[model samples]
Every structure is written in structure tokens, then in C-alpha cells.
Target: MIKRLSLISASVALGCIVTVAPVLTSIYIADEDAERREQEDLQQFAAKAVMRTELVTYQAFAAISDMEAPPGGLCSATQIAQFARVVFNYRYVRDAGAYGGGQYLCSPLSGDVRAQHLTMPPPDWRSKDGYLLWYRQKNPLSNERQDIQIGRNGNYVSIDPQSYVDLIDPARRPIAAINVETNTILALSPGADADDMLNAWKLAGQVNNEQWHYAVARSASRPLGVVVKSPRSSLVGHWPGLLVMWLSIGVVVGGVLGWIAFRRISRQLSFPATLEWAIARKKLDVVFQPIVRLTSGECVGVEALVRWNLNGRNISPEIFVAVAEQNGLIQQLTDLVLDKTLDELSKLLRSRPSFYVSINVSSEDLRTRRFLDVITARLQGTGIRPAQVRIEATERSFMDADATRQTIAAFRNAGHPVYIDDFGTGYSSLSYLQTFTIDVLKIDKSFIDTIAQDAASSVVAPHIIEMAHELGVEIVAEGVERDVQVEYLVQRDVQYGQGWLFAKPMGVNELVVWLSESSSTLQPIHQ
Candidate 1:
């Protein structure tokens, strides 16, 4: 038992692991894919931003390139101031002037700023014909510390850093344009510091530190490109909720699997157990096959067939019923069938009081008094009369002749007609007919199949018909599929028939509709 319990527990745990492993794996793959997509999107966004900024930078360059040099290879203060004003008039250009001898010659916002101090560019800035320089200083006009860009010589242009900074949306991660030559950030978005932003970019480049993702797009038309840095957390925010949900599902699946494993390993799992559960849950279904009078072609009765639907799969009655009999669960199964059939046929019985319903019975079902009690109790308050319900027993059911005879006598005393089912196929006892007071003998399909085929083969049904008549028992020809078979049964004066030619077995709801639609067409032979 301990070993069995351990196996059950292991099975449950295995089930959970199998179920959750894939979910976690898929989530991880989804995270990686999302990160990849985010990286691509950032790179694309930076590329587009660089393209737009390049347009404005080129416009600035054009403005400066068009300017003419002053006479004497130098610009006077007035010429410098006028040029500054004109350059500032262009969009994105903050201020412009010529610089020589360690001082600005003129400025539009600050006039004659000869004594003023200015930051020097790096030595590498001298080699480039055009250079972009970044420095922080108090603006002469606003008297506030400002991040500034200086476009030196006619080959370069100076513009407001905010123009490029504003291009980075506030909702997105910080972005900046860096000049690789000078190792300077020319412009940065709000909430970003040059030192911290540079460190982030460097850390992102290290394969060991992957917490941050950096997408860099270099400008083919300019010295600088945009770099976008985003934290990894932002890319996969919903993972926490997803992880919790799948883990919970895994636990649930594990519990269910463990229970199933326990049942199986303990030798307690069986179809009869399943059948009992079905009966308790009211899962048994009933279908009716029409039993028609061959001469009149009118449906006089229906056979109640029990069907089991377990977890969306149909369990054949042959398999489950045999299992039930072996396990001594047939009594419970029969009771469920009777209750379900009575409940379903309640309406039809009310409309057609004369309509009889035949129900199959096992020898085990008749060996006890409880079976008779169940039948009596089920019929007590319903509109069904005991006469309207027929009990069908196969010849195999009569193996214990005394018990079978006693059960048949009890049913007859209770006013329920008893019929021998699958007549030609079973024991074929002439003694059962003489010994038991039987009302009907249903000719099995095998014998009916031989009818009208070969005269010698067809001889059995006629003899059975003649014998049934002699015994004053009505005959039901089962499996009468063709018109010729119907004519043969009618000619032989077989009273009732059931087969696909009339109607296939249908559910209770379908039987109601079938009866309604076929009622007018089914007429007596004399009519």
C-alpha cells in the first residue's frame, strides 16, 4: 500500500511537472521573442529619428556654407553680430559666430563678448574640418546654466540641443546622440544624465550584464547616431501574472492525476465504479427504437436502450454491461436504466397510453426480490401502467430455469408482460416456451437476415412464427431492414417488427418528434 501511494504521488507530481514545464518554457521563449522584437523596434525607431535629425543638421550646415567670408580674412564685430542674428533666425540654431584668437568675435545674444570666458574643444576637434562640440555654461542671455552645442567653421553648424532631445518621447526610455570621436553626448532626453547614460550604454554592451537593452543606430550622413537604452523589466511586465496562472493550473492538474493514479494503482478503478458514479450523477441516457406492427405499419411500442456517455466518449453497452454483470453491479445499472427510461417516457406514455416500452433484463436482475421492488417503486406515481412496460429476457437469462421461471411468474403476477429476446440465437429451448407463460418471442436479426434469401435458410423464421402462434404468443421480427423482408413478415402474420427500415434508435427528445411526424403516414393495412 505504501508503494502504491508513493507511485500515485509520483504520478501526480510527474503530471504537474509535465504540464507546467512546457508552459514555463513557452513563457520563456515568449519573453525572449518579445525582447528581440523590442530591440528591433528600438533600433528602427532610432534610425528614423536619426534620419529626421540629419535633415535639420544638414539645413544648419547649408546656412553656414552659404555665408561669405569678411574682407581681410576676418569678421568685424558688426558683421559677426549680423551673421549671428541671421543664423539664429533659422530653426534649431541657437546662436552662431566666428571664433579666433581664443575668443568669440561676436554673438547675437551677447554683443562684443571679447572678455567673456568660453570652453575649449578637445584637441581631436582641430583635425576635423567640421566638428560638433558640447559643453555646459551659463547662458549670457538667460543667465542660467545651459547645455550647448558649438558648430565650428563654415563646415559645421550649431543648433539647440533641445531640438534633438525633444525627439525622444518622454514616455519612452532615455535616448541620446553621441559623438564617437570626442566621446561626448551632443544631446540627451529629459531625465538622463550624461555620465549615468554613458555607463548604461557601456554596461548594455557587456555580454555578462544583460539587464539593460541598448539599440544604437549610426547616421550614415552625420557623425552622430541615436542610442536608445531600456531596462529589461519593461519588456516583460505580464510574466508574473502568467506564471501564477499556469502554476495554479499545474497544481489542479496534478491533484486530478494523482487521484486517478491512486484509484488505478489501488485496484479500485473499474467500469462498474464509473457506472455507479454515472448513475449517481444521472449521466445514463435512454434511446428508443420503434417496435412497429408489421401488418398495420404502425408503431405500437419502443425498446428502451441504455447508453453511457463518459467524459464525452460513448462507452458501448456490450462492454460496460458485461463488466457490470461480472462485478455484480448489474442490479444498480438496471435500476438506473428503469428510472431513466420511465422519466424519459413519461410524456409519451401520457400521450399514447397504449404504447408499450420494452426494457432488457439480466438473469442477475431477476434472481433477487429487490429488482421487482425497484420496478414496483418506479411505477408507483407515474402515468405508466405495469401493462405498458414489457420485460425482455434473453434465453441465456433462463439458464437457471427455476429462478428465471419464478422471476417471470412474479412479473406476470404484477401485470408486466415478459418476452424472450434474441429468440433464434440463444439456447433455442422448446421447453422454455412450454414451461414459462411468455407473451412475446422477438425473432433475432440473424434469422430475419436469412428471410427471402434462400428457401432452406428462410425456413426457420416461418416455423418460429408458426410455433409462436401455436403458443398464442405474439412475434416481433427484429432487424427487418428491407421492403421485401417487411412483406415476408407481414405474409407470415408476424404481429410486430423493429429495424432501421422503420426508424433507427433515437434519443427521448428525437422519439417525440419522430412519433409526431410519422403518426399520419403509419396506417392500418385495412385502411
Candidate 2:
């Protein structure tokens, strides 16, 4: 009885720690959370600031770059209509005109410049590029607002000042600006204190003694920066609530675990039991991410992904799948997924006979004829063809050559094309390519991401492509998010593509709606 009591105490404590670790760690790092939140906020502000300021600068510079001295100079409307038309297309410019002698410039605003002239105050600052700029110059058309008027030599453009800081939260009073050539910090928003802004910029990612948070963010392309400061108390408002919530969770978890440990210690109430229970109760969910043909952009098929929830919280398939593999529960798990998959996709695959669904199986599943038998049994009544189901085994599955090769042959003989998933990431062998008769190779996302990059693996993709071409197997690029990657794959005449660029993983209902809604965009392709 004493030994049982000790076991209960240890088990409950272990369970409690495992569950409450993240929450407790969160409490410890809540201070850092304020810094992170502020950094993200300032980053957004900085990006907007730089984008707006650069766009306005671009408009002004573009007009300046394209502008030449009018044959009639400042008093005449020499192609003033052309200049006005260009400015109309862009939302930033308040005015455009020629500048000379610090006075009376012909502009879109100056209808008859020979008779009426808009005088200029001396510029607030001069840029290194021989351009003159005014800060918050009062609008002659409306005293209620101001604009930034900048010009050089024969032309100038005035930008609406409000557009620069429009996205900023007015309540936060954050300051944003662009650093132009010659290290000039051009302010975008009003009420900027140069010293305070600079101090916050240097003291980024730090909490002050008074519990105030200060942060600064800079753009990668330019010297544009945003500086913001907030009271730590504002962001940490839910601290007490979260503290109480986690504490209550700990108490409840510990009590439940104590009860479980006391009564269930003699039985198999561990992870395997929980998994077995979940399988029996049908607690696993399968989501499908579409795989499309590269050239035609047709939704050719989908890959089945398994998801599990334990005690109302999601457990990553990476962790739990490994658990299943280690505990020899993978076959049962695969069976459950296979049964669910055919039931869900039977209608879709049957309607689109050309389309196929790929299912990932473990190294263990590929060792013998049992897996093929299970699959054959599952597809018996679903109206789904064996050809409509593809088998995916990672490179690790091919390590056990005799059994895996036999299984792959059985699957292929049964009309299921075998694919080597995440091909380059596993197993140090070119032997698998010579040995396993895989119909397709799904290049891992890691290699796909390296396309056109300066990384060392950038060269590896071309070699992999060349090797695949030599072997006569089709290619499927995974995790393709960028147009550049699609272009790269398309240029190589790769067969298929999959990732967020096409579609995200979704449920059966969503997939049906998606396929129906997006059919117009997809072109029919033959396998």
C-alpha cells in the first residue's frame, strides 16, 4: 500500500509537470512577451512608414527624373496637362511644377502662371542630391492641412503629409520616418521628439525601470525605422487572469491524475492505451492538401494528413506518430486513417477518375504484405480504384531492402504507384534509386526553398532534377510558396507541385467546395 501511494504521488507529479510546463514557462517569460509584442507592432509601423514614404519619394523622384525644363520655363504651361495626368494616377501628390529662383512656379494649381504666382517660403532643408524640401508646408489651397513640397532644378512634387502616417494608430503616438541618402531622417508623423525617438531607437528590446516598454524596428531595404514606447501594464493586463487560470488548471490536473494513478496503476493506462482508446472512438481527423499538375495547374490529387487530439489539446503528428511507431500501434493507426480516407474521398475520386490520393505509410508498414492486404480490403466497396490510391514511403522505408522492395512490388502490381516522399532529406544512398522502382519523387520543401537562393543547397536541386530526369520518374515539388519556385519547376518540365501556393490542408467539406469553386482555374491534364 505504501509503495502504491508513492507511485501515485510520483505519477501525478510527473503528469502535472508535463501538462503545466508551458504555462509556467509562459509566466516566466511574460516580461519578454511585452518586448515581442512591441517589436511586432513597431515592425508593422516601420514597414508601412517605409513603403508610404518610399512610394511618395518614388512618385516625386519619378516625376523629377522624367521632367525636363519646359520651353517656356516657370510661367508657361508646357505639357502641364501631361504632368497633371501622371500625378492623377498616383494618390500621394498634392501638386507638381517647375522650380527656379525661389519664387513663382508654373504648376497644375497655377492655371495662368503669367498672371498668378504661388510664392514659396525658403525650404526647411536641402538634400544632398541638390533637391529642396519643405516640412509640413501649409497648403495654399487649404490652411486646414499641410503637405511636403520637394523640388530640384526644373521640377517639384508636393506629397500629401497625412498619407505617410495614415496606417499608424493615432492613440499610440508612435513615430515613424525614412532615412534617405546622406543619412537624413525624414519624419513622417507630427509631434516627433528627435532625442526621445533616437533614445528609444537605441534602447530597443529593453524594459525601462518604470516598467515602460521601448522598441524600434528597421526595414531591411532602407534605413527606415519606427520607434514606440508603451506602459508594460497595458500589455500584461491578462497576467493575473492567466496566472489564476493556469493555477486552477494545475489543481484540477493534479487531482485528476491522482485519481487516475491511484485506480489505474495496475492497468495499461499509458500513452498506448490512450491512443488505442482514441482509435476505437474514432478521434483522429484526416485533412487533405491538394497536389496539382505544374503545367496545367489542375487539382490532380491530395495527400492525407492525420491529426489527433489528446485531452482536448492537439498532439503533433510528428511526436505522436513516432509514439505510434515506437509502440507498434502504427499499423492500427494507418488502418484507421485508410478507412476514414476512402470513405471521405470515395465520391470525389470516383467522379474524377483521373485524380488520385496519396497516403503516407510508415517504414514498418512497408516491411510485409499485410499493409497491401489491408489497403485492398479497404478499397473493395468504395468505388475507388487501386490506381486512384498511391503509396508514399520515405527513403527510410527502403533501408530494409528485401521486404520493402517486395511490398513496393506488390503495391505496384496491385496498380498503386509508389512514391518516395521527402526523397533527398533521408538515407545516405543512391542505391535506393537503383533498387526501389518508385514512380515519383516528392522533393522535400527544404530543397525547394533553396531554389534561386545563395545557400549551399541551391546547387543541389538542379542535380536532383537532372538525376530524376535520367531515371524517367515524374517530379513533385513540395512546399512551393513562391512564383519563382513554380517558374523554376515549370522551366525544368517537372510534372506536379504542392503547397500553400496552390491550397492549404482542409477538411472534406472544404475540399469539395474548393474544388467546385476553383474548377475554372484548373486545366485538365492526363495523369
Candidate 3:
């Protein structure tokens, strides 16, 4: 009994360790990720602020550049005042004037201050040629400190620092702008302080501070730099909630491990179980590939393809569909594909009554009544005619020959067309054409792809088309991506074609735009 008690204690301890280690590790990683994202966001914000400031500065400079210098080499009082008024109309320009001969010549606010012998202060920030300068000085009218810029030809434009500062989003974080040459604070948001602002400037491009994080980006067009600062707490505001979730997960995992130590339980679940979860959450989506008429190059129909977005990754349809079919989940997947296709294409179908959308179905889907019921229910009041919906099944999907034939006949009786998809790649049995009521034969991409490579080896596609034509079935050549391929299909009298050359698979909104843009040039198939 003592030995058994010791073993139980050891197992419980090991389980707790196993459970706690990962939760703690995940929390640490989460904190690090949050910090990294915060730094990146701050850098982006600073870059944008600097860019906006530079644009305003450049606009003012451009306006000044357009003004011709007075003929007498000194701007008259009237001309200076008028130029200043034009500059002041811009949002960022606070005042404007002309300065020459170490004297203030004229200004819109204080015209002709020539007697003052005004001295132009050495610029806190200046261009290489001393053409553009930004400095701080007292406003002659308001008698308050102001930031100003001087152009090359004695034209001066004062800047409203408040306008530049207000461009930074105050609700995001504490931000400030400073001159790189003079180390002067050009502007600062309400919550920011001089001490923190200076610290942030020093800590630019670094995130090692324990109390505060800093990001800075200098404008390429000017000498100004923008700094974004945030307290460590704000950077990791979600840490507490993450900690609670991790703790709860740890408790549950530890209990499960401990239970497994005593009771032998199978931990492996089937693929269908996971797939069922995905289906329940509606993680399926549909994309449409246009089918064009070769002669007129007009889109006549679209093929609906289902996509699986699982865990932020896209899983290929071939792998998932095969697994689903083996595990008896194909019916559910097919039903979902049908519902999503009809719902998405309903608008296009209603607007263009002649347009058709094809949906792929598996052998299992054809064998069951549930598939037909799903299609019927989804199209009841959706403004989609029964004929507008086409069913496409592969040659192998006809393995249950009787059931597939019955389904196809029933579908045809209800005004829906059934097409044989991926022909010449699958079962490729001639009996499929003779036995089932196939309306369209879509030659697989494998055959169409070989048409350009080996003329002799690619003879199968033409023969297939001839045979399909003899049986009164329309031909659709898939993967027609080249001009040569289009010419070949049109020459062979192929009715419908689809490939990336025309358009790749697109979402509903993109299809609507494409249709609107191409409608004028598109013509219906001859027959």
C-alpha cells in the first residue's frame, strides 16, 4: 500500500509539471509577441505622422516657389502682403512675410516692419542650401512663441505646430515631434511630458526599457522626427486575461493527465470527428471559375469550387475530399458546398437568367437523396432557377452506375443539366456517355495542358471532342490558358472553355465586377 501511494503521488506531481510548464511557456511567448507587435505599431504610427508633416511643408514650399521674385529685387509692401495672404489660406500656414537686407520687409500680420531691423535667427532646422528653414520665435502680433519656415528667395511661411501635432492620434499613445538639429520639442500630445519625451528620443529603435517602450521614425523629406511612447502596462494589457486562461487550461490538462494515469483511454480520434467540428463552425467557402464560350470569348457559366480554411491555413480540396469520402463525411461537405454555392451565386443567377453555375458532387452525393434535398431547399426562394444550377460529377463518380444514372435523370427531369467533369482522367469509360444523360463533357486539364507540348500525343482531346459532339453533348475544354490553346479550341468547334487566360477562380464580388466590366464585349454562344 505504501508503494502504491508513492507511485500515485509521483504520477500526480509529474502530471502537474507537464500541465503547468506549457501554460507558463505559452504565456511568456504571448507576452513577448504582444510587445513586438506594439513596437511595430508604434513605428508605423511615427512614420505616418512624419510623412504628413513633410507633405504640408512641401506644399507650402511649392506655393512659394511659384511666386516670381519682384522685378526690383525687393518685394513691394503690396506684393508681400498679398503673397502672405495666399500662403495663409493653407491649413498649416500660420503667417507669411518677406525678409531681406537683415530687415523684416513686409508681413500679412505686421506689414512693413522694415524699421525693426529684424534679425533672422539661425535656423534650428535648415536645408543644405539654406533655402528652407524652420525655427521658433515670438509672433509679432500675438507676442507668443511660433514655429516658422523660410524659403530660398526671402519668402517666409510660418507653421502652426498645433496642426502638425494634432495629426498624431492622441487616443493611440503619447507622441511627440522634435527638431533633430536643435533638439527642440516641436509638438507634444497632452499626456506626454518633456522628460519622457527626451527619454523616448534617446531610446528610439529600442524596446529594452522596463517602464516604457519607444519607437521613432525621422522624416526623409525634412529634419523632423516623430516619437511614439507607451507604458509597459498598456503594451501588455491582455496579459492578465491570458494568465487566467492559461491557469484554467493548466488545471483541466492536469486533471485529464491524472485520470489517464489510472484509466486506460484511447486518445486518437478519427479525421471525421475533426471534420465534423469544422463543418459545424461553417468553415467552408466557395470560389467560382468562369467558363467562357470559345468562339465569342464570353463567360457563359462558372464552376463552383469549395475551399477549406482550417486553423488559418488552406487545405487542398483533393486531400480533404478523399479523406471525407473514405470516412463517410462527403455528404455533409457536399451539402455545405451546395448551400454556399447557391447562396453566393443567387444574385448573379437572378440578374443574368441565362448564366449557369456548376457544382461538383461525389459518388456518395449522387447516391443519396439528402444531396438533392439540400439543393432544392437552398434554391427555393433564392431567385435562382433550377436550370441555372448544373451538377458536375467525375467519371469515377459513376461507379454506382444505377444510382448515378437515376440521380442524373431526375436532375434533368427537374430542368437541371448534369456535366461529366474531368473526363479522360478518371474512369474514362465510354459507357458513361452511353448510359447516363450527360449534357456537357469537360475535358480534364491534363489533356488540355498537353495540347501545346506534343501534337501527336495530345490527339486524345480532339477525339474526345468529336465523340462528345456526335452524342449531342456540348464540349468544355478546361485549363485553356494560352492563345494557341484558345485558337485550337475555337477551331475544333468547342462550345465552352475555362482557364486562367480568361479569368482565375474569383469570389462573388469579383465575379460581379468582372461581369459588369466585360458585359459589353461578351456575346452568347452560337448554339
TM-score of 1: 0.49
lDDT of 3 by residue, 60-177 (tens): 6766764545434455665775676566666567777777764566777787788877676655566675665655566666656766565667777777665555642445577777
| Residue pairs with backbone atoms closer than 3 Å in model 3 (clashes) | none
Model 2, 112-164: lDDT tens digits are 45344566789877766687777767655677777777778757778876555
Count of clashes in candidate 1? 0
TM-score of each: 0.49, 0.50, 0.49
TM-score of 2: 0.50
In candidate 2, stretches whose alpha carbon ends up further than 4 angstroms from where it belongs are 1-269, 523-527
Q: For model 1, how does the per-residue alpha-carbon lDDT over 242-348 read when each residue is reduced to its tens digit?
A: 65665567667656655655575455456567777887787878899999887787889899998988889998998888778878778777888888888888878
Question: Following a full C-alpha superposition, what root-mean-square deviation does model 3 have from the true structure?
Answer: 21.4
Candidate 1 regions with alpha-carbon error over 4 angstroms: 1-269, 524-527
lDDT of 3 at 327: 80
Q: Candidate 1's C-alpha lDDT?
A: 0.70
lDDT of each: 0.70, 0.72, 0.72
